[model samples]
Target: MSMPPPNRTKSAHRSPALRPVGPNSLMADLDLPPPTNPHVQPVLDPIFDEPDDHGGPVDPVVLAAAMSNLNMLQKQRSNPHSASSSPVDSGPSSPNFQNGIPLAPPMSSGNSSSVPGTPHFGAQTELLKALDESTKVIRQNSKAPTRAPSVSGIGAVVEKPDYSEAKIVVAMVGLPARGKSYLSNKLMRYLRWLEYNVEVFNVGQLRRTKARHEQEAGKGKADHSAKFFSHSDPKANAAREQLAEESLEMLITWLKAEGGNVGIMDATNTTIERRDKIRQRVARDPNLQLLFLESVCTDPAVIAANVALKVQSGDPDYAGMSREEAERDFLSRIAQYERVYQSIEEPGISFCRIFNVGQRVFMNLIQGYLQSRIAFYLMNLHLKPRSIYLSRHGESIYNVEGKIGGDSDLSERGWQYARALPNLIKDNIGDGPLEVWTSTLQRTMQTGSFLPFEKKTWKSLDELDAGVCDGMTYEEIEEKYPEDFISRDEDKFNYRYRGGESYRDVVVRLEPVIMELERQENILIIGHQAILRCLYAYFLALPQDQLPYIKIPLHTLIKITPMAYGCDEKRYPLPIQAVDTHRPKPLRQRKNTLENTPILSAEPDELVFQSTTARDYFGHLPPLSVGTEQVQEDVSADTKLPTGGMIKTHGLGLAVEPGALKEALERGQETGELTPRAIAER
Candidate 1:
C-alpha cells in the first residue's frame, strides 16, 4: 500500500506576516484573477465581520465541520478566477455550503434599523463570527506540543507523572538464539538508566543450568538433548514445561513484592499453548499488564551469524565440548524447536511482532509511557553485523592550553590530523558510502572536514557542559577554587560543577543518539571526549564508577563491533605527536613544597635524535619521555619552577587557600568518595 503525500499546512499560530490573508485585507496587493462570469458579482468579505450572536452558545462539533469544509475549499479545489473565490464568502447560491441548518440570524439589518423590508447583509456576517469563535477553540487545543522534553536542555518545565505503581510484563517469543537475551539486556540497561525498576528472568538459562547439573551428577535417567526440544515427546515436554512455569513463578513473585515495575521473561515462548499458560497466570493481577514481543527471522545468513556467536559464548550446555560438536548440538536443538514453533497470533493480546530483524514492525494494542518507550527502542535494534567507529575531535586551541570546554577551532597540528582521517577510514572501512556524524562545535566540524562521506550534525553530540569552568584550565580552576577541584577528583562521574552538568547527565542526553546509532550502518562518530565516553560505556557495558575514567585520547580511533556474546574492541593510534596538555593536582600552599620532591624548570631541554626504524620514513616515530634519578642531587643548582598558586583570569588573579583545600580532600576521603549515583540511590 502507498500513502499519499502529507498535506502540509501553514501554522495558524504563526507570525502575522505568515498568517492567512483574506480578499479584503492589505495582502490583496497580489493581483486577483478575473471572474469567470462578468455578470456575477464576486463575494468579497473578511473572515471575521460584525458580531451577530448576543452571547448565545454555539455547538463546537457543527462549527468544526463547517470550518473544515471552508479550509478544504480554500486550500484544495477553489480557483481564484471563480465567482465565489473568497474564503469567507459562502454565497447562498452555492449548494455544497447549504446543510439544511440555520446559520444566519433571523433578524435582518433593515429590521433592526428604522428602514423595513430591506434585505439582510448581516447574514454572512453572523456565519463568519461563529467560525471565528470556533477557530479560537481549535487553536487553543492544538497549541500543546506533543514531543517529550529533551534530556539535553536545562530549564525546561515538564509535567512528570508518578508511574511507580504501573507494572509491566514483557514475554519474549521467538526461536532459539533469535537475540532474545540480547534484547532483554538492552532494554534493562536503558530502563535502569532512566531510574525505572526493571528485571529480566531468562527461562533458558534456568533450563541450561538444570541440564548441566543433571549431566554432571548423573541424576536424571534421560539426558537433555535435541529430543528434549520435541513437542510430541511427553517426558521431554514435561521437563521443559516445568522449567517455563518456574520462570513465570519467579516473575510473578518479584512483581508482587514490588521488586520492580517492569519484568521480562526471556525464552522461546513459540507455541500458542505456552503463551496462553503464561497469560492465565498473570490475569489475576489487576495492576499488571502483559505484552508479547515476538522476533521473526527468515534470513539464513543472520541466523548463522547469531548461532556462531552463541557457540563462541560457551553456553553451559556446551561445557567441556569441542567447538565443532557444540555447534552441531546447538544447531540440532534449533532444528527440533523449529518443527513445532508457533508464531504469536492471539487476537486480544497487546504485542509487538518484529520480522526479519526489524525490517518490518507491527504492533497491536500497545500504549502508555513505559510500553511506548520500550517499543520505540526495540524498533531501532537489529541483529545485523556492523561496527561503530568513535573518535574524539582533533586537538583544538582549547586543548593546546589544557582547557576543559570551549568551541575553539582546530589548531595547526589538529588540521594535519584531520586531513589524514579520510585515508585512515579508507584503510579500515574500505571504499563505501559511509555516514559521518559530528557535534555542532567548530572543532568537531573542522576535524571531519576532509572526509568525503555525507556528514550530519547533532546537538545532542555536543561536548559536556563545564558551565562556569568552561574555557579554563584545570590548574587555573584549582588555583581559584581549590575546594571544587578536590570534590571533582574524589568522584568525577557525579560531581556536577556549579551550574554545570555531570557524567550521569551526559548519559541521559546520549540516550536518543544511541538509539539512532543502533538503527544506522557504518557510522563514523567524530565527537567530544565526554559525549563519546557515554556512548563507549554503553556498548562496553562498563560500570558507572569507571565511565568517567575511560581514557579517550585525541588522535586515536576506537572501533566497536557488537556481537551476541560481547562487544569486540580495537584502538588504532595515529603516529602524530601532539603536546600533552593534561594537568595534575596543584601543590598544597601550606606545605609550600611539591610532593615527591624534585627540582624542575619552567622550560626543559629539547631532545634531537635520529629514528632507527624504517617506519620513520612514513612519519612514524617512538614517543619521548624524560626521567632522571639524579634530579634530587642537582636540585640546589637547578632553576626553580613557578608556584602557579595564583591563576590569571579575566584580568584578575586569585590565590588559593591551602588549609581549605586540605579540609576538602580530607572530607572526601572520610566519605569513601561516594559519587552522586550512590547518593541518589541512597
Candidate 2:
C-alpha cells in the first residue's frame, strides 16, 4: 500500500517546547514509583507534564492506592486485551465510595488509617473510594475550560497541526539488473489494489529513449568530426543529464496537478548525489515526503542468470549490455551504490535494503533484521509494525498413518503443496525476500524440498518422538497397554513414550533452537505441528499449561513480530494442493493379490512411477500384519495407482487404505486380538 505524502512544512516548524521537571518534583513524588526490576532503569520523564495550581501534597493513603492503580494501568497497557480496565483520576470529586468515606483528594497526604477512628475506620477501603472520586473529578474537569489566567508565553498551549494533505514521493534505486523493475511493478500493483492514485516515472527508460532519438537525428553528423560526437561522448552525457532533470521536473508538475498522494520514481540512482537532488527538490514543497528503496542481490549468480534470460528476450533496458557485460556492471556498482545511499540518512528519507537470497537463509536474517528495524522505525518514524507471517508443512502419509517418527516421505499431495509454496509465499508477502526454516525430519525435509531457498536442516528441529509407538496406529496402542494410553492423556506434556519422548521433553530440547531464532531477523519457520506450537507459545507468552494444547493446523503459515511491549502475529492458510488432497493409496493398503498386480506400473494421473527396481532403492517396505493374521504377499513387478486407497492387485503389493487399517485395528482391539506391546514389537 502507498504511504501518505510527507508534509515538508512540518519539518520546517520548531518542535513544541516541553516542560522539564526535577526527579523530586511534586508530580513525580505523587505519581511515580521506584523501579523494581534490575533490567528496568529509571526513565526520565517525558518532555511534558507541567505543574498546576491544583497540584498539592498527595495523601499518603490515596497516593498508595494511586500507585497500585498505576501499576495495574501499566500492565493493562502492556497487554491491551486484558480484562481489567484502568481507573480514572477524579481529583477527589468522584461520587463512588468503597465504604461510607468520601474519595481521597488527588493531592491528599497522611494515611487515612493513621488517624485510627470511625472517620478512618476502613482507611484502605476509604482511600480507594476517595481515589476513584478524585479520578472522576479530574476526568470531568479535563473537558472544562480553566478560569485561571494563562501562565504567559511559558505555559502557552501549542495546538498540534494536522497533515492530511501531505505529499509522499518514493524512489526505487538499485543496480541495473537486481530485480528493481520486478519490485517496482509489484509495489505499483499493490498500490493500485489499495485504490491509491499513483504515478510511476521510469527515468532510465526516458533517458534511453531520448538518447536513441537524439542518435537517430545526429546520424548525419561526421563520425570523425571533432564538432559532432557520438551518443556515448561528453556532449551526449550532458544532454542526458539535462533530459533527466527536465523529465523529473515535468513529472513533479504533473503529480502536483493530479494531486495524488503517492509518486514513484523508478531509476538506477547509482549515486547519493543524484537521489539527494530529487529529495532536495521535493523538500522545497512543504507537503512533500521522500522514501528511498535499495535492492541488492545476495546471490550474484541468480542475477547473472536473470540478466542472461532478459537479454535473450530482447529487453530494451539491457540492450546496451550483453549478458556478461550487464552482470559485471551490476557487480561493480553494488558496493559504491549501497554505501552512498545508506550514508544519506535524513528524517524524510527512508532507506530500506532489500536482500535477494535463498528463502531459508533469508528467513533467519529477515527475522532478526525485522526485529531491529521495527524497533528503530517505530521510534524514529512513528510507525507501527506490520506483516508477520508463519507457516508449517502440509500433512504427510506418515502423519495420517499414525507414525510418530519415520521420514517415510510426503504423500502425493504433500509434494504438490511443496511446489505450490513459492507462489503462495510470493503472492501473500509481495515481492520481498522471505525467510524460511525447516526441520531435518524426512517428512519435513521432503515437504520443503521444493521451496526455493538456502535451507539448513537443524537436528534439534525434528518432530516429537513416539518411541515404541513410532509407526503404530492409536488402536494398536489402546489394545496393548491401555494404562499407558490413559496415562499419556492425563499428562500429555510430561508423558514420555516407552522409548520416545514427551512434549515437555521436546520443549526443553528446543531451548537452543528457540534462542537462535530469537536472535534472528525476519524469517518463516517451516516446522512440524507439535514443535511449532511450542515456538508459538514462547512468542505469545502463553503459560506452560497452554503449550501442549496450542492447535497448529496444517498448510498454514504463521508470522509473529516482537513490538515495543509484546508480539503481533498473523496467519496465511495455504490453499490445499490438488495432488495432496487426492493422494494414491500406499503400498500396504490395496486388495490385489501379489500375483495379479505388477509391482512396477505407470499410472497416467499420478506423478509417481512405480519401478520394481526402485522399490529396493528406498529399502524394503515394512511388512503388513493384520492382528495375528500374517499375509505373505509376493512382490514381483511394480504396480501404480492413480489414487491411493484400500485395494490389492496381483503382482503388486497390498495398498492399505488409511481408514481401513484404522478400522481393522479398532476391531482387533475389541476382540483382544492385537496388543500395544505386540504392535510395538512388530
Candidate 3:
C-alpha cells in the first residue's frame, strides 16, 4: 500500500518573493520552464488575515478543511521538460524541499572502528560539480549569511530593485501583567543565538531608573501607587509617555551607533494613541521596520501566574511592600490600564497577536523574511514549566587514551557510571515522563543503555566532525598542522578545520534540535562533549563565541529549567572517576614565546617535544570517586600508565580545549608547581 505524500504547497504566510519570476530569471535564458506556482492560499488562514473572535482560536474544523484543500492543490501533471519525471516531483518543481520541512534521510557510517560523526547516505561530489557552472554567476557576489539576495542579482537583465536592509524595532503591546516582557526576552535570546545583533529596551525599567535617581537626589517624591497608572491622571500619563519616548530614542540610537540588526521596545503599548505615537516616530526612518507584538491572554490561570511572578520578583513599583499589598496594588494598576486598553485595530501597521501563548496566533500585514521568522517563532512558545537534562557520555577508551571522536565502547569505569545514571536521574527528576536522547554514536548510546525511558538518537547530536584529522592525538596535530592549530586557537568559534566543521556550523545544524527541545517537556540528552557544550551554551544563554570552550565534564549531569523570561540551571556531578579533559582559553603568545607546551606520550618511556599544547596523557589518571591523595597518585602512575590504550587517534570529541592546554602546562604540568602527584608527594 502507498501512503500519501506530504503537502508541498505554499502557506498563506510564505513570502511572495519566494515565488518564481521565470520570465526575467536566468531560467528564461536557459530555455527551462519555471516550477509551477501553487497559489493555494486560503482566505481563512489566520496567519494572513484575522481570525474570528477578534484574534482568538480559529475553528478547528475550518483549519482542517483549509489544510486538506492545500494538500489537494498539488497537481500531478507530467513535466513537459523531462519525460521520465514521476509524480514524486510532478511538473518542473524540484523534489527537494518544495515544502519547508527538513528532509534529512537516514545515513550509514561506513566501516570505521572509531567513532563516526554524522554520515552520508552517498557521496555528493558529482551532484555538487553538476551545479558549479550553473550557479557560478550568482555565487560571484558573496553576501553575509541570513541576507537574502534579490532576483536581479542572479545574473539576469531584470530591473535592479532595492534589497532588504530593514533594521527592525519590535514594540510590545498588551496590558500590564501580561507576558509582554517574557516574549520579548525569549525572542531576543533566540535571535542572539542565531548571530543577530539584537537588543531590548524595557520602558518600565527606564521609569524605575528615573525614579531611583530622583530619590537619590531627594528632589522629588517617588510615588508608584496604583493612582500613578490611572487614565484620568494627566500628569502621570504624560510622564509615562515621556519615558516611552526615551526608551524608543535609546533603541534608535543603539541601532544607528552599533549597526544593530533588531532592536526591541519592551513596554505595554496598550492604547491606540500610544501605538499611533510609536508608528509616527518609526515612520521617520526610511529603513526602520516597526512590528507591534500583542500578547493576549484570556486564561485567568495564566494571568494569575504572571501577576504572582512579577510581584514576587520584587518589581520596583512594589518595593518595600508586603506580598499581599503588592499584589493588590499591581492588580489595581492593571485595572487602570485595562480601562483604556484597545484591541489593536491598527489600519496599515504590521502586527501579530499571540493568544494564550500560541494556542492560537493571528498575524496581519507582516511580510519579509525577518518579520515572518519572528512570527513563526512566536507560534512555538508556551508558558508550561519543563526541565531539560543535558549530559555528556561517560568515559570511553578514547578518553582514557587522551584521543577524541570515536564510537568505542565504554571502559570499565565508564560502564559503572552508565549503570549509576538511571538512579541519579530518578533521584533528581523524581517520577515523571522523562525521555532519553542520545547522539548516533556508540559512546553516547552506551552511556544511556541503562535508561528505562523512551529513547531517540539524533544525527545532529553527533560530536563535532574533525574532518581530515579524525583520530590523532593533540600533540600529533600541532606537529603536523601548526598554522591550523593556531588558527583554531585564535577564533575557536568561527575556525573551520581544513575539511571539518566550526562551532558556528554546529550551531546551524542544531537549529531543528533546539526547536524540538523548546517544544518538548522533560527529556534527558546523553551526548558528546562538543554537542553538549553547544546545548549548554544555548540553555545558559552564553555568547556564541564562548561555546568552543564551555567545560562539559564527562559523567556530570546538568538540569536546565525553562522560565518565563530566562532559564534556571543546576549541575550534578556523580560519584564517578572520569578523565579531566578541560582546557581553558590559551594566552596570546608570539612565535618563540610558545613555551611549556605539553606533548602526548603513548608510553612512559617516550617523550615528544615542542608540541605547543599539553595533557598528562600517561601521568594523571581520571579522578577517583572518593578522593585524591598521594597513595592514589602513586597507584595511578604505576597502574593507569601503559593500560593498553589506543594511540595516534584524532578528532575533537574528547580533545583538550584547542590552545588553553598550553596555558595549563605552563602554569602546572611543566613547572611542577601543581603536578599530578603533588598531593603530598611530588
Candidate 4:
C-alpha cells in the first residue's frame, strides 16, 4: 500500500544546446564494422536531415526508440573486435573514390601497417592514414546509445516511476446547506477531466437505501411518521449510525476496485467520531491521502433561505419539509446537533472551511489537492493564518423567547441560519483543517446540524442554570418573591437564584472548559446565549459586571480571536426577521419537559471561592445621594478606592451609549441585579 516518493528532478523544458540529432544520426557516430569486401559503398546521408512530414526533424519518440534498440544490440552480442587480431579496412572501395574526389575517410584500422610510419607501407599509405584518422574523429563525436526519457525533466531521476495505481480518498465535510454536495460534484467533474478515476458516495442517499433495506428485512418496524421524524428513538439512531458506517464501507470497496486515483465521500460528517472512523479505515492504505473540506456560511439569512429552498425543492437527500414542517425539523435537528457537539473528544480532526460562493472555492480546494507540495512550501514559510472558527447555534425556540437559558430547539429561522452558515464559511474562509464545537443543548446543536465539519459537543458548554426559575415567567418570579426580586435587582452580579447559579458560578464552572479550549487549535464553539456571553467576556477581558450584560442576540455569530494580549471579537448577525417568541407561555399551560430538563450539578470543588468582594471592576463611582435617599448612582465623579481600585464612572462613554445602557439596565432588572451585600458576598 505504500507509495514511492515523488520525483524531485527539475523539469527540462528548455531546448538543448546542440543541433537536433535524428535516430540514424546517432548510428552514424557509433563505430560499426565497415563493409568488408569492397562491395558496399559507405552511406552519405546527412545526420540532420528532416523527416518527410512537414519538413520537420525526426520525432523524439522514434529517435529514442531507435537508440534503445542500438543499445540492446551493443550489449547482447560480440562485436567484430572480439574475433579479429588485425582490423580490416572495411571501407567501401568504389571507383568514384579512386577519381581523387576527397571524401570523408573510413574508420581506423587496428593494424599498424594501415597507420602511417610503417616501414612496409608505400607512398599512397599516407592518404590511407589520413582517412583513418578522420574516421576515428567522427566515431568519437557520435551520440552514445542510451534509454529514452519517459518524462520531461532535466536530471530528474524517478526511483519508482510507477504511479498509475496510486489512490487517494478525500472527505468533503461542512455544515448542511454549505454546499458539501455541490463541492463534491465539482471535484468529481474536475478530477474526471484530469483523467483521474473518481467515485463519489453521498451518505444521504445511503441512509435512505438502508432505511428501506431495514424495512424490507423485517428487522424493525415503525410508523412512517415515527420513522421519518423521531429523533430520540433508539431504532432511528441505530439506523442512522448503521447507514453512515455502511456508506463508508461501500466507499472503501469502490476505492479497492475502480477507484482509480481518487474517491470522495460526501456526507454530514459533523462529528469527530465519524471522521476518526474514516481515518482509521483509510489508514491501512499508505498511498491514500485523507483530505477534509468544511463548508461554512456566516450569513444567517442566506443560510435560512437556502434551507427553505432545499425543503421546498423536495430533495430526497434533504428532509423535504413544508415551510412549517421545515421549521420543526430544523428544531429537532438542532437538538441532535447539540448532542453531537457535546460528544466531541480529543486529538482533534483537521478540516478546511469551504465557503459556498461558487466554483472559486471549489477550484481552490482542487488546487490545494493537486498542488499540495506548493501549499506545504508556503505553510512552512508561514504565509497563511492557522485559524479555528466557532459559531453559536443558530437561533432556537427558547432563544426567541427572551429566556435566559433553555434547551428548546431552533426555530424555522434558525434552520435558515444553519443552512446559510456553510456558504458563508465557503465564501469567507477558503479551505483547511476545521473542527466545530457545540454545547450539548438543542439550540446550539440545531444551529450546527447543517454544517459539514467534524463536530464535537462539550457538556461543559451547556447554558447557565436558571434553577427553580427554569420555566417560570418574569412576572411569576416577581409576584412570588417580591422582596427577593427587589434584592436581586439591587445586586445583579452576585445574585444567585434559589436553585440556579450566579454569573460568578458560571465563570468558575467554565474554568475546565476554557482550559480545554486553550489546548485546542482552530475550534469553533457553538453554545447558548448566557454561556457564550460568559466565554466571550472572558476572552474580551470584560469585567464581571459586564459579563451578564453582554448582548448576544439571536441568529448572530460572534467570533473571538484569542491572542497574546487579549481576544479580538467580531459579530456576524443574521438578517432574518426576528420571530418574536419571547413572551412566556401562559401560567395555566403545562411546561414542556424538554425545557424544564435538569443538568448535572457542578462539582463542589468547581465552586472555587465562596465569596468575592466587588472591586469597582467596571470603573463605576459609588452611589450618590438622590433627594437625601442615597439612591444608586449611574455616573458621578470618578473615584479611587483603596488597593489600586479606580472607578472611572463617566457613564460608560462612547462605547456604551446612553440609550444602550438604559436598555441594558432594563434587561438587568428583568434578570436580576447585584445589591451592595451581594457584591460583598461575591
Candidate 5:
C-alpha cells in the first residue's frame, strides 16, 4: 500500500478541480429506483454472491435483464455528437457555453420529471449516464490509475497501483478514555495490516516516558492527571505544550523518513488552540495532510464502560493501585480535560467528529484517498471493549463435492455443527445480549438459525469472489485454468479472480465490517472462510501474506477479546462431524503430480491448536468465560479418535506425532499461572 508518486499538478489546496462536490449535488438528478419485478430479485442475488456456502450463478433471464438495462443507458450515447453538444444550444457558441463553460441542457419542455411514467428504463438510463459523467470527472481529477488492470478472464492477476507521495498525520482529539487510544491503535493496526507504513506517535506515552525518566532521576512523581492537561493552568499548560512540541517534532521527522506513509498523533488534542498548533505545524508540509479525528461520547454507560476498561486494561498510572483508586484517578483525569475541552470547530481545518462511536459521524474538508480511507475506518469504531465471536459457516454440500465457491445448502454434518453451535456459545460466552451477524447467504444464516440472538447480514461479509470459477472445485480450476490456479498460489493475496475479488478487495470491503465490529459489544459472526479469514487476521494482527493462507476450518468457533496491548483469542471446536474443506498448497504440489499430500491426522470432532499459546485454548483468558477446568473434561471425554477421518494441521503436516499431540493436550489442561489476560495486561 505505497503512495503514488508525487503529482506535478497544483497542490490540493490550490486546485479547484480537486474540490469535491456536495453529496446533494452529486445525487440531485440521479435516483434510480429498484426494479419492481419479482423476477429480477433472484438475478440480482447472484450479483452479490458470497462463498460456496452462499453463492450461485446468475440466471440467463437476469443476465438478459441486466443487458437490456445497459442497452437503455447506451441509447442516449448513441449519437456521440448530440451528447457532446450543449443541451440549450441555440447556436455553436450559445450563452450556455459563451465562456467555454458548458451547462446541462434543460429538460424536455414542461416535463416535470427526468423520465416519464415509465420510470424503470428511462429513469435508470438517465441516471446511469449522469453517473458515468460524474465518474469520468472524478477519474480525471485523480492522477492515479482510475481502475485495476483488466481481469476479463479468471487468470489475469493484476498488480495494484501504489500511492507513493501521500502522507497523513491523524491527530486524536477527545477527553481521556473517550476512545482516543483504542481508535488510534486500531487505526494504526488496520493500516499496517493493509501493508501501509503507519506509526502512532502517542503524546501520552511520550509524556509518561519523560515523567518516568525524571522520577528515576529522584525527581518528584509526575502528576499526569487531568489537571496537567488544563489550558488555564500556566505551569501544567507549559509542560503539556513542551511535550506536544516534542511529540510533533518526532512525528514530522518520521513523516519525512523513507517509509512513513501515515503517523497518528494520539493525545487529548481537545482545545481549539491545541488542534490549531498541530494543523499549523503540519500545514508547512505541502505534501502532508493533517486530519483531526475527534471521538466524542456522551452516553453514560458507554463512558463508564470505557473508564472501567481503562482502569482494568489501560493506563500505566493505574498499575499497583486498586480498581477503586484507579477508577477515581482516571475520572479525575477526564474532569480536568473537560474543563478546557473545546469541540473541534476550527473553520477550514480538515477534521472528522465521530459521535459516540458509530452512532453518528461528521466530516469537513476530508479529501484524497488516504484521508478518506482513514475517515471511513474511524466511522466504524467504538472504543468500548467487547468480545467478537467469529466462525466459518458450517460445511456446505459443495464442501463434500470439493467445490470452491457456490451457494450450496449445508451438508448433513454441517447441520449437525449448526445444531451444536448454540451449546458451544453458551458454554464459552455465558450470558449476554448476543447479536448474530452473517453474510447474506442461506448457509451462514442456517448455521446461526438455532441461536435465539437477533441476526443481521452484510453483503460485504461474503467470501472472496471466485468469478467464473464460483461453483468449480480446485481440481476443476487447475484443469480449466492452470495458469490462474498457479498464479493464485504464487501470490494469493494480490491474485484477483477474473472479474472477481482478490484478498485485497475482500480486505477493503471488510473494513466497514471491522469498524462496525469495533463498535459492537458481543457479536457472533457466522460467515464464509475467506470473510472470516480477513476478520481473524485483523484482530490478531496477522501479516498480509498470512491472511490469505490463514486456515479457517469448519465447525470451529473463534472468540477474540480485544484488550489494551493485544487481543486474547480462543478456538472452541463443537462436538459435531464436519468435512475438512481446507486445501493447503504445499511446496511439493507445485508443477508436479499432486501426490503424497499431507493427510489430516487429528480427529474430526476434536480441536486442533495452532502454534499459538496453549493457554489461549485451555487456560483462563479474559472476555471468554471458559477455563482449563472445562477444557480438561472435554479433552478427556473426546480423546478417542473418530473412525478413519484425520484432522491435520497444515503447517505441521506429518511432523506431528500422535503420542506428542496427546501429551501436549494433557499438559495444556494442567493448572498454570494466572490467566493470559493478567500476564498481557501486566
Candidate 6:
C-alpha cells in the first residue's frame, strides 16, 4: 500500500478572502442581522451529489436551492460585464478608481425598497451583488477550446480583474548571508502556491552577470572584492548604485507591464540612499506598495555558520579562491558593506525586521492584505537545519482488498510493517527529537503506535475522502461511475470526488499544516497517499501538475533535510511486503458520470494525536504546547527591548544594533521557528 502526497496542518487562521461569510459565521460577529431565509445556514453543505460513509444527509425541500444561487455567483464572476451582471463602473477616470472597484450606484430615488412591503429589499439586492462579486468558480477545463461560450445563460468560467491587489515591491534590506535569499524563496514558494504571481530580482546575481559580461568583452575584470563594495571608493559606490537602480527598474517594469503581483528585490538595500531610490520609484504610482525586510542576527554562532556556508558554495565572489582566502575576502566584503549600511528609518514606509531568524520580528506601517501575509509568514520562519520524515501508514485491510479510501484496521502484514517502523526510525534518525503525527484514522495511528515519540493527529493527514465510493475497489468504481473514473484519470489533481474532496482541495486544506511544519525542527508524519504527496511536493518544490503523481510507497520513510537554498532527501524503505494501492492514469473513455452518487452528510474528522510511545517515554523531547510571549509593539525612538516581549512603547520597533546583522552573516544556526503564540506576538 502506498500513501498519497503530504498535506498541511490546521494551525494558521484562514485568509479573509477564503473565510466563510454571512450571519451564521465569524462574519456574524460584526452584528449582522439574520438573513431573510433564516433556515439557510451560512455554511451550507455543497451539492456534492453523493452520500458519505453514513447514509444520505437529512435533506430540506430546498437543499438544491442554494446551488442555483452559487452558480449565479460563479456566473457573475466569470462574465462581470454581462448585461445580467454589469458592475457599477464609471470608467478608469472615476474617483473610486483607487479602490479598484467602482462605487455602488445610488438606490432608486422614489422607492424605499424594491419590494413595497419589504423595506430592506434593495439592501438585500446590494448584499447579494456583493456576494456575487466576491465569489469565484475555478475549473481548469472550463475554457477548453472545444467548449463554446455559454449561450444558455450559464457562466463563462472567468474571474473579474481585481486591480486592488496592490502591486507590491518587497525590498530586502539586510547585510550579506543573512538568509535574505532563503526568505525570498520561501516567500515566493508560499505566495505562488496560493496562486499569487510573485517574482524576485536579485541584485547580486545581476551584478555578477554584468561583471562576467564586462570581463568577456575585455571591458574590465569581474571586480568582486572588498574594494568593490567600499563606500569610500567613489567609482565602486557609483557602480553599485547603478546596479541597484537597474534591478529596481527591472522590478518596476515587471510589476506595471507584466501584471506581476509582487516583485521582490532580493538584495542588501542596507543603506538609506539605496532604499530611498527604491521608495521614490514606488511612490510615483499610488497603486504600488513597498515593503522592506531587514534580517538582523545578533547571535554569533548563527553568523559563523552562515559565513562558512557562504564561501563553501559555488559563488562568483570567491570563485577560484582557497577556502581560507575566500572566507577572509567575504568577511572583508561584509565589513565594507557595514561602513555605509543604513537601516530603514523613513516614516510612512512599510518594513519588517526579523531578529535572529524569527526569534522575534518587528513590523511597522504594514498595510494591505498581501503585506500582512508577507509579515505573518516571515514571523514564523527559522533557519535551523532539520529533517522531515514522511511515510505512509502500514498496509490496511482495505489495501489488501484493493480498496481506495476507508478507515480500515491494518492487516497482519501491515501490523508487521507498523512494528518495524520504530527500529527503522531509530536507525535512520538515531534518537533525534522526533514528533510523530498521524491522521485520526486508526490505520495511520496504529502504524505509528510503536514509535517512542510524542504523537499528534491532524485531520488533514487523513487519506483522500473517496465519498460515496469509500469502500469500493477501483474496478467497482469503474463499473459504477464510469465517467467519473475516466474524468479522474484525465486530471487527477483537480478531479474532486463527488461528495468528497479533490487533490486540489487537499492542497488547500493542508496549507496551514505546511506552515506548522516549516516552524518545526524534526517531525515524523504517518499520513495517507494524497497527504504525503502534497507535503513532498512542497519540500521538493515540485510543480502542481506533477504533485499527484509522485510515488509514496508503503513502508518507506523519506527523510527531507532543508538547507539554505534547497532540500535534500534520503529514502529508507523497510523490508515489508504490502499490496499495491497505486492506480496509474487510466485511458479516457468517458467524460461524465453515469449517474449521481449517494450524498452522505460527512462527519468531521477529529484532530488529536494520542501519544502511544514505546517503553522509553522517560524524557526525550519537548511538548508541542504553545506558550505566550509579549513583544514590544508600536515601539518608536531607538531604545532597549526586553526579551520575551513585554512592551515598552515609544513609537518605532526594536531597532537593530550596528553590526548585529554582520553577526548573522558570520553565524548561521539558530532555534527553529517559534510556536503559534510566538508568531502571534510578532
State TM-scores per candidate. Answer: 0.59, 0.30, 0.65, 0.30, 0.59, 0.64
Q: lDDT tens string, model 4, 28-87?
A: 567766434231123233232223422222222222222233334323223222221121
- Model 3 is weakest, by summed lDDT over 10 consecutive residues, at 77-86
Tell me the deviation in Å of residue 1 in model 3.
42
lDDT of 2 by residue, 1-682 (tens): 1111112332233111111111222243478775342322333323211223422212222222332343343242223211111122322245632232213211122332111111111122433344334323322322222224432111111111112243556676665556555455444433332234565666655544544444556533222221111222444334434544655675677568876655667766544345656777877885565666555553433444333333334434345665455434433343323332321222223444455511211100111111222212211111122333455666778666765566666655565565566667677667664444567665665555444543445556677777777777667877876876766645455566655666655664564455335434455667776788777766554434345555566676666755322345566667774223222333332332123212234463222211111011111212212111121232112211111221112101112232443455445446643333222111
lDDT of 1 by residue, 1-682 (tens): 0011112233322222211221212234556674342222222221321123321112222222322333342232122211111112233443422442113211122222111111111112333333334323322322323324442222211222234566889999887756677677777767765546777888766665554444456555334556667655655565676677777877877887865788899888876667778888889787788989887765554455455555545455555777567667777787666655655544456677666666656554454445645765676676655788998888888888888888887776676677667778889888765767778787886677656665656667888888778889878888877876776765566666545667766665676577667777688899988888788777765545555655677888888876543466778889876666433323332133223211233322211111111100111112212112112332221122111321111110012232433344345335643222221111
Candidate 4 vs candidate 6: the lDDT winner is 6
User: Which is the winner by TM-score between candidate 3 and candidate 5?
Assistant: 3
How many pairs of residues in model 6 come into backbone collision?
A: 41
Tell me the spans in candidate 5 whose CA falls farther than 4 Å from its real position: 1-154, 190-196, 210-239, 299-339, 358-362, 368-373, 383-387, 425-442, 445-459, 468-486, 512-523, 561-567, 583-682
Q: How accurate locally is residue 649 in candidate 1, as Cα lDDT from 0 to 100?
A: 19
List the candidates ranked by TM-score, beginning with the highest.
Answer: 3, 6, 1, 5, 2, 4
Total backbone clashes of candidate 5, pairs 3 or more residues apart or in separate chains:
12
Deviating ranges (above 4 Å) for candidate 6: 1-166, 585-682
**For model 3, what is the C-alpha lDDT against the true structure?**
0.58
What is the per-residue lDDT of model 6 for residues 2-113, given as tens digits with 9 covering 90 to 100?
0111122334232332223222444335777644432233443222122233222211111112222333432332232111111122344656333332222212222321
Worst 10 residues of 4 by lDDT: 114-123
Q: Estimate, for each residue in 424-530, the C-alpha lDDT of model 3 and write its tens digit.
A: 98998788878677788887876776566656666778888776677777787778877667767776776654456667666756755675576567889998878
Q: Could you tell me the TM-score of candidate 2?
A: 0.30
For every candidate, C-alpha RMSD to the true structure in Å: 29.9, 31.3, 23.7, 41.2, 23.8, 23.0
lDDT per prediction?
A: 0.56, 0.43, 0.58, 0.43, 0.58, 0.58
Q: TM-score for candidate 5, please give it.
A: 0.59
Backbone clash numbers for all candidates listed? 0, 81, 7, 54, 12, 41
Off by over 4 Å in 2: 1-389, 577-682
